[model samples]
Target: MEESNRIVEKTVHTGQQQQQQQMSSSLPATTPVVNPSNPNLQKKQQHIEDSPIANSLPTDHITDVDEYKPPTAEEIRRLTWKRDLRIIPLVFLFFLFSFLDRVNIGNAKLAGLMDDIKITEDQYNGALSIFFAGYIAFEIPANMMLNKLGPRVWMAILLVVWGTILASMASITTGTQLIVARFFLGVAEAGLLPAIYYYLSVWYTRKEQAQKVSLFLTSLSLSGAVGGLLAYGIVRMDGIHGMGGWQWIFIIEAIPTLVLSIVCFIALPDYPEKTGSTFLTEHERKVLLDMLRADAGPAPENDPEFSWKQFFSVFKDWVVYMYCITVIGVIVCIYSIGMFLPSIVRGMGFTSLNAQAMTVPPYILASITILINGHSAARCGERGLHVVASVLLSVVGYIMLIALQGDSLAGRYVATMLITTGAFSCYGSMGSWFTSNFAGRTKRSIAIATINCAGNLGGVIAGQLYRDNDAPYYIHGHGAALGFACATILFSLILKLLLRRINKKRDGLTGEERATIIAEEKADNLLEKHPDFRYIL
Candidate 1:
């Protein structure tokens, strides 16, 4: 038995040496060697290195292979919960304020912003549309900065700057001033959503991200609900210090955002590998890193240094454009509903204060739907179907809005609930789908920024969709939103089919062919081009 044990140990040691040699060829020889004298530690390490999860990562990316041990299921669960507790609430509040500052113009309009500024409806719409001009222009650059400065510093800077700009809205006396403030506000806020998405991607695996993203994004609906309630109260403060209710709305909302900016700067973790938090033990950190590497494999993009070539190369992918267009459709519905819900409710014959209060319920309903759809997608491991179902629900709501009579107040209100619920739920799935589909951190960053930028163009489209001319049953607006919803469904199906076809082609290649392709791609540092890099459809 002693001789047999010695022979097995020899075989394991030989295998470890071979693996270490293989890894060293692709990466620097920096990994510490495991102590062969510690038999139990050696056995545990060997078991982990042999596991399917460890084998999924490329050798070049396994920096701590000698030290890795597979975390127990309970350990992973507890760690995930701890991460959720630390990250979700703060990020959620940040985005909640971000979204509120963007859409609060709608609340302010109902509180007499347009009349106070002496702007025509067309000019008001122009102000709304122009924000996206700055937002789209800065998104990619902002994400590049976030990658360089790290999430904590970059995001906090953005939050504080935008919060200051958002407050300055209370001081604008002319349409031009309001327009300029809105534009700069857009520029300041541009980096935040995409930055948060990228930050979360680095921390969590593809499977774990959707639900977390949903929780974070629930801030959108919460902002709508909370903004409505706040607006209801603030509007009553009209003429206080000779400022309009709209001005009070801007001032009050800005205060909390500025406070949170300081909190975020101090509290937010940079990245898992660089985190200085006491919440995670050294072993937990190692396990987390290994899990992330295993989930996506490694690429040159994982390196801290920025690559302009890799950044621009994202534009070359047809899949990226598909995702961009798909999100645009969804964002059209979301922005239109979010911007116009108060107006839509007021048109149903409610007073201004009652309309503000009325906006809360649909958003509350939407928030509930978003959580359900997000969790269900994660649980079922499906993306396209859940997104399609949600958008179709919006289409149905739009159709009901068009068909139902204005006097049928309760029914039309139900339709509004459906619209909010459906439109909001699609966001979480679409975000997770696109983020996971892209490989490489730099490429993923640019892809996410581009998609989000394109999607925000929907805000421009939405600004013009619901005009005063289309008053009490805005058939044109409803019809246009319905069309976008259908387009989203069509685009999602096409992308899914295309991905499946590509995955199928990959599966049919022989081992030698795949091996040759992988070697050639690896030589070029084209990680996504590797034959084994499967799409997540």
Candidate 2:
């Protein structure tokens, strides 16, 4: 039985009320009636339509054919603001702390971390690389678990688990211990980024997604800046308790994540369908549901509540791999910068503490650029061009870093800014692009997890790129970064062309042909290949 049918049948309530609740909780949010063929059932639906709840909803604008004239621009703007207030702040803080904990090792290294741990440069690199081992291995499984357990319970659990692991890092005395802790830290932290992306998709439409995701991606930049400033102050507490500044950075930063775990459990909502009346009024809930369903198109009659076959089918889609390939190089660039920026700045002749401070300006510029790029993409409804432009900028930056003379300090610093801005901006535009292209919920979930897991192989590579032995003008590191950024541009253009070709082919089909394809796919219980569905370019 479909999950929605099972839900309606099992609930011990009046049939009309059960149908009403089911509409609130069900995917597709199809029009609710006890039964279309029964006269009594039709009356029940009419009763609902006449009720105060339905009266306050946008149903007056809904036509008999199930088309709803969406909320006006002003109404959508107001609702979006309300949603932003509820969702963005908490997730933003969660990712901020999560990223800080992950990358503060760069700051810690500046505070004599390797000296205290007594590790060689190769061992330090091994420690960095191993984190992604756990991260990549667990990402898909973690997202699957998230779907099973729901975001609130699973996210809160992950937060606490990763926080405990991060705090434990302060006591490690050997490179192997650091490697082990960092690995588990990756294991515990793996679910966070992909899960948050999926969660945001649940709330926002495609048009709203790029800007919202960019807002969230800003945490990466903010965390970099925040991590640098915090390290500047906290490292000054060195030897206060006979611990190195690196140790203090680990211990102190882990505290906020632990606190936020409680907040996540108490406040983070799961899905629009699952939210209680106190969380969202009936009118607001219905409007939100209508907006989403209208934007995505109504679910087909044969659409299942969930399908394992569809979940696994993402692997068969060639576009999924294209997404994976496009992101791999971008991930390498992002991880390389996040994990090594402070060290890179120090190599530019700044003092250890001053390097931490100097990392702030580039991240600040990148954050601003991300917000602007995101809004522009969302407003213009263009992805490939924005992504190409941003990454092209990074390519230029990498070229400058590799080719500039050693004495050109100002030139090198400017190159870092360009790298940060371009690479960081890619996060939002590219992410929203691929995610919007995938069709069904389960398929999208698996595709996102797969693409992210595959892309994180770049993180493993990043750990090896900028070795301590290759400091100051690390030719190999800058050269590899340049090559990867170029690969991103290449794959992005290719993917864009491929999607456009597919969309153009679909557009050539007649209405009857399109209907036939949808019908056949529905018979197979697949939802992602509707001929009428157009990919976002």
Candidate 3:
């Protein structure tokens, strides 16, 4: 009776979700990985295989195969929603401090950090922006190593490095000193975001990753809101001896990260395969592994070692490029506003306290925007619409700020919320898009690292975009940010169209033929061919 019920449930749900399993008659005659007419796509693909990109990382070698088997809706939900959610809060809490450590410097400046250090204005700006230089240098290697090292150790180690550096920053007396420390701090923090995304992929299927990405990425918003209160409160505190508020910003915030590091060492699980026999019973382990295997095929445990051919394969994929470009434009809008919003608010004639207070609203809006779109995307198995909407919202926000000259407190306040909401929403949506589009350990890791590395370049540029000369109005900053938002729209359109074309080409095969193609695509594993995986919308 139990076996009969299980069979009935799987059939009913699978038919509802994927009735059109057979490829349609009008599909392309032949769909080759290589194309002649599209140079940019060809170059993007070749770029993955050439020299540094191909040889530089671990994501190139293994893709566990799954056969196309129709999973019941019950099985789909079990893998993605339940498993993906468990690790999200963990990533968010860790990143909360990670972002805080980076941006709280801006908060510190408002609290008179520059004055306390006796630094020139230019030097202070230099210190604030220097972290990106270091961040860009080590991102890929760090992410490559992150999976090999595993999240439990890698994340904690990264936190310790950055958190310790953050604490050490309090002792610096000059701008030069601060810049050097921040540079190293960036190096330490470099792999974390991409690595966490990659790590999250191991546990959750592409179908489940969107909401989880949003949940994890929401830390940036939480950081904005909570960092303000923390920065506002801590900077004002009466501390030991004669240390100022910014000094405490370092010391106080660094402590929690340190505490979490220890907790991470104790509490975090490495992978299901290495089940240590203590935390989860054998039955629970089998259940969890069954869910992942159902969705992603099987996690190939015994495999050939990493190779350049495989590492370069990700670059050839094309999806990563679209993901990277789309994210770069949006992240610029995110960091540009983030880097300058406090200063912009202060420039509008409000005191530092009031300016800080003004930032709170944007973060509130950002938190909700990120989570809602992300959750919807994950639930509906969609990735395209939310990303486009997020960018469109940003375009509106950017146009409003750039086209209109506003000096009123309410006007500047409103602009901040609009830009923040739109930019952060795009960020969350893009993250969901990223994981859903890539498969296999090698491909996903390199894909995430490469995309993030490109996106961080925008951070380097954002530091320069906000000019001191435009202080009273900052028209130049608003215009540049708007331009990037428009670029975001372009990339979004291109990515959506490109993926749609790929989907159409594959649509011609029979259901069984299509399953065979996907199984081969997932790599050589025989087990992964029949999972009935669908493209994350």
Please rank every candidate by lDDT, starting with the best: 1, 2, 3
lDDT score, candidate 1: 0.83
lDDT: which candidate is best? 1
For model 3, residues 326-429, the per-residue Cα lDDT tens digits are 78888788788777787887887878877777777788889998989887876666777788788777777767666656545566567778888988888887
Cα error, residue 138 of model 2, in Å, equals 0.7
Whole-model lDDT for model 2 versus the true structure?
A: 0.80
lDDT of 2 by residue, 232-340 (tens): 9999999988999999999999999999999999999888877787667665666676555544543322132555887778888988999999999999999899999
- In model 3, which runs have C-alpha deviations exceeding 4 angstroms? 1-12, 15-86, 238-240, 297-308, 510-522, 525-534
Relative to the unseen true structure, what is the C-alpha lDDT of residue 526 in candidate 3, on a scale of 0 to 100?
Answer: 24
TM-score for each predicted model, relative to the true structure:
0.90, 0.87, 0.81
lDDT of 1 by residue, 1-537 (tens): 121122223334555554454355445566555678989868866787775334433444444645456555466667777788889998999999999999999999999999988998888998989999999999999999987899999999998999999988999988999889989998999999999888888888777777888889899888999999999999999999999999999999999999999999888888888876576887777767766765664444346767676788888988889998999899899889878989999888999889999999989988988888888877765788889999988989999999997489998999999989999999988888888777777888888999999999998899889988888788899999999999999999999889889889977988677667757655336656655566766
Poorest lDDT segment (10 consecutive residues) of candidate 2: 1-10
Worst 10 residues of 1 by lDDT: 1-10
- For model 3, the run of ten residues with the poorest summed lDDT: 53-62
Among these predictions, the greatest TM-score belongs to 1
User: What are the Cα lDDT values of the candidates?
Assistant: 0.83, 0.80, 0.70
If candidate 2 were superposed on the true structure by all CA atoms, what would the RMSD be?
Answer: 7.8
